[model samples]
Structures are given as C-alpha cells and as structure tokens.
Target: MPTPAGADAARRYPVDPNSRLNVRSGPGTNYQLVRVLPYGASVPVNCQKPGETITGTYGTTDLWDNIANGQYVSDAFVYTGSDGYIAVRCS
Candidate 1:
C-alpha cells in the first residue's frame, strides 16, 4: 500500500509499556481491528484525527494516530513523551 508522505520520519511512539495496544482499521473502536501492538513496538504517527475516547494507562484521550495507510491506534495507548508531539491531520 502507498504510505502517507513523510510519515515514516514523524516522531515515533512505542505502544505503552503496560499493555498491548489495538491497531485498528480506523480511528475508533467500532472500526475493524487491524492488528495488536505489543509493548515496545514503536511506529511513527503519520497524522491524527478525533476518535472514540479511550482511557489507557497513560491517560484518557480521544485522539487516534494514523501510523500507516489504513492503520490507526488510540493515542492513549502510545507514549510520545509528555504532551503528544503534534502531528499533521490525515487527509
């Protein structure tokens, strides 16, 4: 699949060390599940969009990061340091 332009170099966020994070087909839990990201699995956040709110170990947030062409993960399940590094919005 064609990747999002320049997304690979965006700041990387590893799934939070506490648990496996869901990688979904879209930004919300209602979307199909794409994969499961184990702790320490890091990926660049290509962009972000508003999604279902998820209260993960890190905190609660309604943001989702598009890490790949059709893959998204809840922002609450990833760690990009304090105050997530803002990324471009996906088209």
Candidate 2:
C-alpha cells in the first residue's frame, strides 16, 4: 500500500536520541531481545501492534512498531509526531 502523503516510505521515525532502543522478536519486553538500535537511529514502521505499555523518552503507550519481520521496538521511544498509530495496524 502507498504510504500517506508527507510520510516517507512507512515514514521513518526518529528514535529517542538518548536511547539505544531495543529491537525485539515480538511486540513487548517479554519477547526475546533481538538487537539494539544505534543511538540517534531512525526507523521505518512497517506496521504496529498493541503490547505491554512502556514509558520512554516520548511518553507512555502499549504501541509497538514493527520495523522488520519479527522485529519490533516500543513506540514510546519513537518520535512519530503523534500519540496514535501512524501506520496500518498489523494483522
């Protein structure tokens, strides 16, 4: 599907500059940790899901961003410029 106008390919969102966000196998901290995003990294949110709510640099939420297949990061650390879903909800 085409991305919304003014939003890049899925809209790359900035990770909290002070954080090295954890990439997980699933949408919550209970999931396996896959990796850590670099400081100042930005990520394209392919989709989203609601999971364990977390509080981070951006605020608090249960929203998790799927950055790749089987990879996710808490939306609380992503600067998506909104408090709601910015991409399609993951099936």
Candidate 3:
C-alpha cells in the first residue's frame, strides 16, 4: 500500500501502556477489526480523522489515528502530548 505523505517523518507516540489497542479498518468501532496492537506498542500516526468518540486511557475524543494504510486506532489510546491533532488531517 502507498504510504501517506510525511509518513517517514511522522513522530512515534506511545500507546496506552496498560492496554492493547485495536486497529480498525476505518476511523470508528463500527469498522472492521484489522488487528490488535500489542501492549506497550508505540506507533507512528500518519494522519488523523474524526471518528466515533472513545474514552480511553488518555482521554475522550473523536479522533482516530492512521498508523498505516487502512489501519486506524483511536487517538484516546495514543499519547501525542496534546489532546489535539498533531499530524496532518487524513484526506
């Protein structure tokens, strides 16, 4: 799959240290389950988009982070330092 622009430059962030996060096919839970991230996994968020609001270890938000092509994880489970978009918005 083609990687998003700036993906190589994307900064890696820690997932919720205490939980294994779900990777979805889209930006919401309604989407298919793509994979399950391992505990203590750090991911590079390529982009972000608005999705179903989720309350996770970090905080509640509607942001879903694109870690790879067709791979998304709830931002509430990722620590990007701020409770806001840190990367480019997904197209």
Question: Which predicted model would earn the best lDDT?
Answer: 3
Model 3, 13-74: lDDT tens digits are 99999998999999999999999999999999888999999999999999999999999999
Q: What is the TM-score (0 to 1) of candidate 1?
A: 0.82
For candidate 2, give the lDDT of residue 30: 92
Order of candidates by lDDT, top first?
3, 2, 1
Q: Candidate 3 has which clashing residue pairs, if any?
A: none
lDDT of each: 0.83, 0.92, 0.93
Worst 10 residues of 1 by lDDT: 80-89
Q: Candidate 2's C-alpha lDDT?
A: 0.92
TM-score of 2: 0.89
Stretches > 4 Å off in candidate 2: 1-7
Model 1, range 1-91, lDDT digits (tens) per residue? 9989875566687787877788899989999999998777987888888889889867898888899899999888878665554787777
Write model 2 residue lDDT over 44-89, tens digit each, in one string.
9999999999999999999999999999999999999999998889
Candidate 1, lDDT over the whole model: 0.83
